[model samples]
Target: MTLDPNTLLAILAMAAATVLTRVSGLVLIHFVTIGANQKRALEAIPPAVLMAVIAPTALVTGPAETLAALATALAAMRLPLLAAVATGVLVVAVGRAVIRV
Candidate 1:
């Protein structure tokens, strides 16, 4: 199957945009000096973004997802991030199997 010219152009445009975004962030960081508070806020961004993405799905989805998100939060209190995420995945799988939802 031949790739349509528009599809190829769109793909190339997206790739360029992604690279430009990442490179711009790096360049900005290189020129900027961050203080302690700013650094702390920056460090918090990943978890905030993760929760922002997960919270809506957990709330909007069925019981299994909600239960799994709860489990993940509880696990996160004691475990590392990776383990907490794994706990969520495991809980969600089991919840879905048992609840059939």
Candidate 2:
């Protein structure tokens, strides 16, 4: 299979679309003055977006994996964010090792 001119053009169009959608937020945010309630809503959005992304994956994982994730989140709460991620990864790795033995 080869990427011909038509295929290349399609790819370029898709890339442009994606870039525009992402940048649209920055453009709007720069020009628009959001009110107090809107600002609060915007602040809340990140956590809600994070939960939306994580909640499904967490629910689908096995019990041990879920426990490991919880441990990681708790650890993260106590330490820096990166440290928390590392702790969670370590927990999952150790849990898997113990299970396999």
Candidate 3:
């Protein structure tokens, strides 16, 4: 299949924007003096963003996603972030397979 030129240009533009945003964040961080509380708040942003994205899906979607999200939350209480996320993915996969969602 042939790639559309407009699609390719859009993809490239998106990639460039993502890179620029990240680079700017890194550069700005080096110049800025962040206090302990600020740093902690900044660190919380990723997980907050992740939950903001997933929570809607879990709530609106069927039982499988909700179960998986619950499992992930429980796992996150005990496990590291990455491990907890993995547990969530595994739960979702198995839930879908078992429940046939």
Candidate 4:
């Protein structure tokens, strides 16, 4: 099969977008001043962003997933990372199983 020029350009565009996205955060951080609240917010942002992204899906899918997410958050606060992850997965699995009954 012959490679088309438009396809090549599209691939390059996607690669550039990906590269810029990954580096933009690091680049922007150099300009920011960190204080105690800023430090805490930065630490919290990843999980907050993740849940924000997932929240609509959970809401659309219904209560079981949302409750499981709540359980996971509670478990995460008191447990080790790995254990918290396991707890989340287990809660989701068990909630799903029970919901189907």
* The candidate that achieves the highest TM-score relative to the unseen native structure: 1
lDDT of 4: 0.85
Give the clashing residue pairs of candidate 4, or none. Answer: none
Per-residue lDDT of model 3, residues 27-80, tens digit only: 898889999999999999998998899899898998989999999999998999
TM-score of 2: 0.68
TM-score for all models, in order of appearance: 0.75, 0.68, 0.65, 0.71
Clashes counted in candidate 4 amount to 0
Alpha carbon lDDT at 97, candidate 1? 94
Model 2 C-alpha lDDT per residue in residues 1-101, reported as the tens digit of each score: 87799989999999999999999988888999889999999898986798688867876877557767788768966898889888888888887887763
Residue 77 lDDT (model 3): 88
Model 4: residue 30 alpha-carbon error in angstroms: 4.4
Local error of candidate 2 at residue 28 (angstroms): 2.1
Please give the CA lDDT of all the candidate structures.
Answer: 0.95, 0.82, 0.94, 0.85
- Model 4 over residues 18-86: C-alpha lDDT tens digits? 999989988998998899998998899998898899778876775678777778778988999888878
**Which portions of model 4 miss their true places by more than 4 Å?**
24-32
Give the Å error, residue 43, model 3.
0.7
Clashes of each: 0, 0, 0, 0
Q: Which pairs, if any, clash in model 2? A: none
Show where candidate 2 strays beyond 4 Å: 99-101
Candidate 2, residue 80: how far the Cα is off, in Å: 1.5
